[model samples]
Target: MRFRMILLIGTSLMLASFTMPGPTTSPTLDRDLEPVVVAGQQMPSFAGVPLDQLFVYAYSGGTWHQIPWQFDEVQDSTIVSSEDGLLDADDQLVFMVADTGDQASQEAWIADENSRQYPRYEVVVTDPLDPSKRGWVYVYHSATLASSVTQDYVNFDEVQALVTSDRYLLGLMTDHPSMDRLELNGSGVDILDRTKIRAEIQFLGTYTEEDLEASRPAATRDGRVRVVIGSGDLIAYRSMFQNILWIDLTSVPMRVLWGRFSTDLSPTASGSYYYDANTSSGVVVDGVSDSVATSPASDWAQVSGTTGTMVRVVDSTEAGGTPSTYYKDDGAVDPTDTGDQRSYGDAGVRLDDPNRQFTFRTWTYVLPPDQPNVGATYRSYARNPLQAQTNEQYHPDFATAPPTATSTPTETPTAPPSMTPTVTPSATPSATPTPTSAPTDTPTLTATPTHTPTATTTHTPTPTATPTTTASMTPTSTPTDTPTPTVRWRVYLPMLRARGSARNAQNGLVLSACLVLGSTPPRIVAEVGA
Candidate 1:
C-alpha cells in the first residue's frame, strides 16, 4: 500500500499599506490604521461553529491581543489584522481553533478568568498538492494546562517511524491487563528471537472505540505493517476487518514450529533418529544428541570426525539383546578428523551374573556416503541345536500247559444225514404242536421279522459322515498367519525406499545408523555436508 504525500507552504508577508515605521506618537485611530494580513493553508473542516471557527492572535509586550480574521473559501487561507494599531510589525501572530464545537460548552473555557483550565486543540494542515503530507500545529487560547489531553488515535507518521523501510513490522496493540498477563506467562519472546523477526507492543490506556478505529486505517495497510489486536476477541474483529493480521495473545501464548519429517522409519526402530534443522540438534531415544558431529564423509565407508559434548548413557544393542557392554572409540581415528574421539563405559552387573562378570567395549565409527546406496544388501544368520536320549527294558514268560484235545460232534437225530434233517424238523414241530410245539414255532418266526426291521433303521446314520469332512475345510484360515511377514515387508520396504529418496534429495548429507555396543546410551551419528 502506498501513502499519499503532502507538502506544506507557509507564506507571511508585510502589506505595503502597513510599511510605515512603527512607534507612532499617537495611537492611530481606527480610520487611518491598516490591517495586517496572515495567510496559511489548512484542510477543509466540517466542525460546528466556534470550534470550526478560526481566530488569529498577536503577541506583543508579554500580552496577547485578539485579532478579527476572515476565512477565504477560494484561497483556503485565513486573513487577519487589526485597525487600532494592535497589529505591529514587531508582533508575532498565531492561528487558533477548536477541534470540535463541543469543547466550546466547557464552563472553564467560557469564563475567561478560568481560561487556564481550558482544553487544548491541535490543528492539522495538509499540503494542497499532496494531501497525505500533513503537519500539526498546537494552539492554546488560554494559560497552558500542566498536563495535555492524551491522544487516542495514531497517525500515519507514527507508523512510518516505528518500522524500517526494508523489514517487516508486526505491531501489537494491547491494554495493560493483557500485557501484564503476557509478561507473567513469559511467552512468545523466544520464538521471535529465534526467528529474528521484529515486533512492537503498544499499550492502550483508556482509549475510546472511536479512538481505536481512527488509528486502524493507518495501521492495517498490508505490506506496511501487520496489526495484531491483543485485548478483545480476535476472531470477531478479524472477521470485521480486512487486510489486518489479528493475533490473540491470551490464546496463542507461544509460537510453535510445525513441520513434517522428510524421512520416516517403518515400524520405527528403537535407535532410529532425526535432526531438527531449527535447533541444529539430533533427537535420539535417550534425548537430544549431546555431541554434534560436523564433517563430510567422502564415502559411506569413511568415518568423519565429530566434535561436541558427550555423555555416557546405557544403550541396548540388538547384537546380543544384552546390556553387558559399553562403547569406547574404535582405534580407527584419523589425524585429519579434528574432534572425533572415543567414549568408554562399563556395563552394570545383572541378576544372573555367574562370575560377577563385566564387559568393556569401544564405539564403532560409520558415516553416510556422498550418495545413497540404492542397491544395498543385508545378510542375517540363525542356528538351532538338537539332542536325543533313549532307554529300553524287556520281560519274558515261559509256560507250556497240558495238551488240549478236540472232540468230534455227534449227528443229531433230526435226520439220518440230509433226509434225516428235514424229517427231524417236521417231526419236532408236529411233536411240540401236540402239546406246546405249535406255540414255540410261531414265536420263533415273529422274532426273525423283528431283527430284519432293526437292521434297516441302522442305515439312516450313514449320511451324517459327510458333514464331518466339510468341517476340516475351516482350518484353511490358519494360512493367514503366514502372510504376516509378507505384509510387514511390504510396509517396510516402501519406508526404506522413501528414506533413501529423501537422503538422496539432500545430496546424502544425513546419516542414520545404530549405536555400537549392546549397552551404551543412544546417540545420533550425524555427518555434516560440505
Candidate 2:
C-alpha cells in the first residue's frame, strides 16, 4: 500500500511537470534588419520571430538614430514613429499615464532627447471624466494620453498625436453617459460638438481580436488625423477632409487597411495604402502627391501638401490573396509582377519581421507620366511613381532589385446598379419546396468600383478575385429586370443544406404523413397512422 501510494504521487508529479508551460526560449530574432529609405527602392526582409511592432530609423550625421520615446520598459519599443517631427528640441510637452487601482497615476515630465534624463513627474489635480469612474486622460504640453490605468496602454496600444502646425486634435472616450468630445482650452474644458461634420461615420460593429492587434490609425506628419475604428468584425475606413481638399486620417477607416499606411507621409489622411502579408513591408506610395488617388476619380483621389510620396494601409492577404505571393520588392507586392492576378487597387504588400541572417532592401516604382491604366481599367497609374529607397546605411549587405514588367488587368462589363440580389415573396404552393432545393439560381455579386485620381481610366474596376480563382473579374450573374418570387426561397438553399439529407428526409416523411392521413378514409388513415 505504501509503495502504491508513493508510485501514484510520483506519476501525478510527473504529469504536472509535463503539462506545465515550458520556459520561454530565446526567439530567433532578426537583428540585422534596417530601414527602407528613399522613394523608389523595394527590398525584402525575413524573420522567424513574429513582428511585434515595426519602427523606422533615421540617419542623423554618421549614426542611425531612433527617438528615445519609442522605447518601452528598458527595452526597444518603437519600431517606427507613429507621428514624427512633432516634438522639437524645446517646444513639446511630455507626460506619462500610469494606472493605479481605479484612479489613474499620471506624471508630467519635460522630455529632452539630448539628455538621458527627464523631469520628475509632477502629479496634477486628478479629475475623473466620470466621478463614478477611474480612468483619466493625461494632458501635456502638446501631447496627451487619454487613458492612464496601466502600463499596457503605453506598451501595446498605439499612441499618436493629432497635431497640425497650431492645434492638437484629441479623441476622448469615457464610460460616462454624456462626454464624447471635450476640448480643453487654457483655462477649462469645453464640450465640442461634431454635429455639423457632414462626413461623420459611426462604428460598423465591435472590433475582432485580430482586427484590434493588426490595426493602426495614423495621422500625417503635418498632423492630419486618422483614427481606425473597429466595430464588430466588419472593417471599414473613414478620413477627415484635408482643408476640404483631401481626407484626414480621422476620416479614414479604422481597420487593418489603415495600419498599412506608410509612416513616411504627413497628411496621410486620404491616400490608398496596401498591406502585403507575404513580404511584410509597409506600403510606400511613390510618385503621387498626397492629393492624388491611386485612381483618377475624386472618390479615391484627394489633394494634399506632399506629392511624389505617400503611404496608406492595404492588405494583400485578404485583398490580393494568391497574387500576393508574386510581390518581390522589399517584401511588397510587385506592382509589375505578371503572375499576380489580383488588382493593385486595394492590395498592399507586407514585410517580414527582422532578425539575424536577414538582409532587406527597399525599392520604389517610377510611375509613367500618364495614368497608364486610365480608360482600360477602374484606376489609372499615371502620376504615381513606383521607385523606392532603403535605409541600408545601417547595414551594407542589402540588394537592389530591378523593376518588373507591368501588365494591364482584364476589364469586366458593367452591371446595372439595380440588378443586385433581393428576396422575392411568392404565394404559390410550390414556392417553399423550390426555395429549399434550388441553390444555383442565386444572384451574383458585383462591386461598385472605387476610382483613383491618378488612374487614367474613366472608370475604376472592382476586383473579382475569390478563394478559388486568382483573376479579378466582375462577378457574372443572371441578368433579369426582376427575379421571380420563388428566388428568395431558392437563394436560401445553401444555408438549408447544413441540416443534411437525414433531416430533409424526416421533413419529407412528416409531410407525406400529414398529406396521406388527411386525404385517406378515416378507418384507413387511423390504421396507417397508428
Best by lDDT, which number? 2
Report the Cα lDDT for residue 378, model 2. Answer: 14
lDDT of 1: 0.17
Cα lDDT tens digits for candidate 2, 202-270: 222211111111122232111111111211011111111111001112111222122121111111212
Lowest-scoring 10 consecutive residues by lDDT in candidate 2?
A: 452-461
After superposition, candidate 1 runs with Cα above 4 Å error: 1-124, 128-137, 141-530
List the candidates' TM-scores in order.
Answer: 0.12, 0.19
Q: lDDT by residue for model 1 over 67-184, one digit each (tens)? A: 3333221100111112322222111122211111111111112213333332222232222223343322223333322322332111122332222111112222221101000000
Count: clashes, candidate 2:
113
